[model samples]
Target: MSIQDIVFVTGNANKLKEVKMILSSESSKFNLINEPLDLEEIQDVDLKSIAMAKCKQASEILGPNRPVFVEDTALVFDEFNGLPGAYIKWFVKSMGLAKIVQMLDSFDNKDAKAITTIVYADGKGEFHVFQGITEGTIVSSRGPTTFGWDSIFQPKESTNGQTYAEMAKEDKNLISQRGRAFAQLKTFLAAESM
Candidate 1:
């Protein structure tokens, strides 16, 4: 199948890298164009809404004729009842990853949820959202402390009990929230293109 060009609007380098890695494949239908834009995100409890808003902004800036997608990620703590859902970027920015993990030190339940929402605009005022969630627990920083909160969140299904940072890139992507969301996007794009 011929690859189709699609704009991926994101300014975060780390995020962009992961998206590229996760979506790259021989059978991949999309040729993701990295178009970094300073799109303003809306403060909302719904993850899909925020992603849709960002996609809309990107579609507007890139032109309504161009197909585009935008992603929003969230780290939600069960103890805090999702205190930093969409505001996780700020939480990590202000408190740092270590301190954020320490916040759950007092609580017995260290459960948390990692979420990724990918919003797509068909360049005709139509919007589609694909979301993925990984259920996990918060632990002390346990691996290479490079990416945001990667060292602290451990997926419950992981047999080795390794954090995202501890796992190989391919292994992590196999179960990552972003990877799952992108999988949905890939499937949708494949069917839509056909």
Candidate 2:
């Protein structure tokens, strides 16, 4: 196949769907594809560093001089002092969202933020990073969606007052951290294509 306009390296179907939706809404001639590539993530507190490292590693492994992008996300809780932060995956695996909300129940402050960083490396290895952050608080897990940390997150800026898991997919795309990041990416790609 011809080189895709961009290839997003990720395993999460939810993310892929959100990004595709964002890109398609542009009505621009840009192609985006996702192929899950597991890479050893460098331990870091910075989401940008991790995303850049993954993008670099993925491009190196793929080795065809194509535009490749990868993203990393962190859910930061003020009560835990951002304890999990970039290490959220392991934290989620061990404690799950229920435990996180439960642990926060005793605290007076429940302020939290969700961050997503996307690093894109061109065939020449030049990288550009886009980030999105949503300020929210932890809520009791609700909804049927299984994506990590969604059910427990209640974004403060949303007018619907629903957790990410509870909103329709398009609604989530409008306000999600990943959605915002991809929105920026879409703009960047459009400008670059000109």
Candidate 3:
């Protein structure tokens, strides 16, 4: 199969790094060309719509026939009925981690979900979206605080009770929402080649 170059539109260094780590391997079919575009993210109730819109915008800016993908991650509290679903980034920025945990203290249920939505635009005006959800709970910050929300979410799949920030990058990626979403993307790309 011929190698394909795909543009990944994102300004976030942490996201880019995590994506690279998730997608990197000798047999990978894509050469991810990073173009950090400052595209306006439309506020919407649907997280997939936000990624789709961003992917289309990136395709328009990059011109026709260039495959491009954009990703959006959300933290949804089950009790809040997905409050701050697409607005998670802003919430984290304004309230900080400590306050976010405090906000959930009033509720007995701390159940939350981590979601990653990835949209790919084929540059022919066709867009495809892939999503991955990790069932988790919001906990007090318990690990490295550098990465966004990693320290606060404990995936139910974790037997050791380690947060994403506490686990090794490889271990985290194996079960992370982004990792699962990218796995679908990789599968799609592989099938596209055949």
- The C-alpha lDDT values of all candidates are 0.88, 0.83, 0.89
Worst 10 residues of 3 by lDDT: 22-31
RMSD of 3: 1.2
Give the per-residue lDDT of model 1 (tens digit) for 84-108. Answer: 8989889888988888888888889
Cα lDDT tens digits, model 3, 65-95, are: 9999999999999989887788888888999
> What tens-digit string does per-residue lDDT give for candidate 2 at 94-190?
9887887887878999889999999988777588999999999888888864788888889998787889988887888888898888889888876
Q: What is the Cα-based lDDT of residue 153 in candidate 2?
A: 89
Candidate 3 regions exceeding 4 Å error are 26-28
Q: Which candidate gets the maximum lDDT versus the true structure?
A: 3
Report the lDDT of model 3 for residue 69.
94
In model 2, the worst 10-residue window by lDDT is: 1-10
Who is ahead in lDDT, 2 or 3? 3
* Alpha-carbon deviation at 120 in model 2, angstroms: 0.4
